[model samples]
Target: MLWFKNAIVYQLNKDNLFDTQAITNAVNACPFVPCGNTDSMRSGWVSPFGESQDNPLVLDNNGQMLLRLKKEIKILPSSVIKQALAEKVTQQEQLFNRKLKKAEKLSLKDEVYIDLLPRAFSKYQFFWLWIDTVNKRVIVDSSSFKQAEDILALLRKEMGTLALTPYASDTPLEKTLTKWVKESLSFPPIILGDEIELKDAVEDSIVVKCKNQEINSQEIFVHIDSGKQISKLKLLDERGMSFILNRDYTLKRIKFDNAILDKNEDFLPEESNAKLEADFMLMISQLTDTFKSMQKIIEEIITV
Candidate 1:
C-alpha cells in the first residue's frame, strides 16, 4: 500500500553508524506533536505504520528501513491579509486625516498575519524515507530536491552525524541518454518506454515531450540529430516496474506492475498491519533489484 511515486536518492558514507536501534531511539526522542495556538508550522518524525502512538516509529524489513516525517503548515492567504491591512490602513488614515506611510502599513500587515495565523486552516504533508543499508543508499519520496533535503535535514539532525551525497557520474546523463536513444543501445533489464522529453542544449525553452510513441523511431531521431538532449525518459524494468528518469538522476512517477502487487493479495483487508508489512516487503524487493540494474547502467556509462 505504501509505494513511492517520486524518488530523490542519496548515497550514505561508509563511516556512518546506521543501526536500526540507534535510529529508532533518536527519532522517537522527537516525535510529532500538534501545532500550538500561535504556531504557524510544525514537523517531526512519526510512525510509518499510521499515526498510532503504539506503533513502532521505524520499520525494518530485511535491512531496509522505513520512516515517515509529518509536517503541518498554517494556511493564511496573502490576499486576505493584504485586504485586511488595506482596510486597517484606510481606517487609520481617515481618523488622522492623512495617508499612512509604507513602514506603518508594513507593521500593520505583520499584526494582521499574527492575528489570523491561529485561526487559519491547517494543511498536512507526509514524506516517506527509505534507507537501504546493504546498498548504502537513502531514497526519499518527494517530487522536489528541496523537499527531500528538508526531510533529510531532520533525519541528520536527529542522528547527529549522517553524511550523504547525491548519485552522480563523470559522464553527463543527458549525453548518455541521448546516445542510447539515437543509437538504439540496449541495457539488459532496462528498456525504453513510450514517454520521453527532449530539450535544446543552448535554448532550454525549446522542449519536446512524447507519449505513447516509439522512442527510437525516425521522428525521435530527428530531434536527437538536431542536438536536443534527453532531459527525461521513461524506462521499464524487466520485472514490470516503470519510472521516469530525469537528467539529474532522480526518478519520478514510479509504478509497480500488478504482477508484483498481487503477490500479497491473500492478506485480508481487515489485517491492516499484516497487509502493510507484506506490501512493504514486496515493494522493497522489487526496488532493490531495479536499483542494482540502474547501478550497472551507471557503471557502463562511466566506462564509455
Candidate 2:
C-alpha cells in the first residue's frame, strides 16, 4: 500500500519555479471527466487521496511533495471484436455476392471499435510524482517512460514554461560507472552491487547484462577489458536499500530490506492512513538521506 514499485528521476532546470499552489491550479483547471462512449481513453488530474478533489492535490509528506495524475482507459476484448467482424463480413459477402474488400473490412473494424467502446470497462491507473524542489528533481513512480512523459506533458500544459530537462552531466555516466567497478569504487556504506549493464561504444546496438556475480571478479573484468562501459549499475547501502542507477540519473529500481518493517510496529496495522503517512515519513527520510550521498557521487563522477 505504501510502496513505490519503480522510480524515474528527472533533474529540474535552475529555475524550479512551480509549487503545490500551481499544481492545485492545474488540477482544478481540468478536472477528470469520464470517457464518453465514443472515447477510448480519458486522462486528467485527481486528488491523491481518493476521497475529495478539495483535498490538496500536492501533499507535503514531511518534505517530499506527492502529486498524482489519473488516467482511464476503456478495454475492448479482441474476441468480441473478431466475432462481430466475422458476422459483419459474412453479411456483406452475402449482400454483394462476393468477399468483402480490404477497404470495407477496415471500415468495419473502425465501426466495431467505436461501437465496442461504450460497453468497455474503464480501467484506471495513477502516476505518482514525488517532487523534491530542494534537490530540483522530480521522481515518477513508474517503470514506463511513456507514463512518466505523460505526467510531465500534463504539467507542461498546465504550468506553461516548465523548463525541466533530462538529468545531465558533462561526462557520460557509463564511463564513470565502469571506472567505479574497475577501480573498486567505494563511498562508505554505499557499495557496488553485483549486477551491471553494459553497452559497446562503436556499436550502439551491442548490449550486455550481468547479475548476481561479483562486480570485481575476473569474469566481469574481461568485459571491461573488451571496451564495454556500464550503462546501469546496482548499488546497495549498509541498510540494505538496493538501487539501480541508470546512464541517465533515473533510478530504475529500489528495494528496502524487510528489516524496515520493524519500524512500523509503533503504528497500528488497522490505521491505513496513519500507516501510510508513517511509512511515507520513514521511507522518504531514508531515501533522501541515501540520495544525498548518491547525488554527491553523481555530481562528482559526472562532472556536474
Clashes per candidate (backbone, < 3 Å): 0, 0
Q: List TM-scores for all candidates, in order.
A: 0.94, 0.87
**Which residue pairs overlap in candidate 2's backbone?**
none
lDDT of 1 by residue, 199-287 (tens): 99899999999999899999999998898999999999978699999999999999989898788888776887788788887888888
Task: Please give the range of 10 consecutive residues that has the lowest summed lDDT in model 2.
Answer: 49-58
TM-score quality measure for candidate 2: 0.87
lDDT of 2: 0.77
Best model number under TM-score: 1
On the 0 to 100 scale, the lDDT of residue 269 in model 1 is 68
Cα displacement (Å) at residue 225, model 2: 0.4
Instruction: Name the Cα RMSD for model 1.
Output: 1.6
Which ten residues in a row are the worst by lDDT in model 1?
A: 16-25
Evaluated with lDDT, which candidate comes out highest? 1
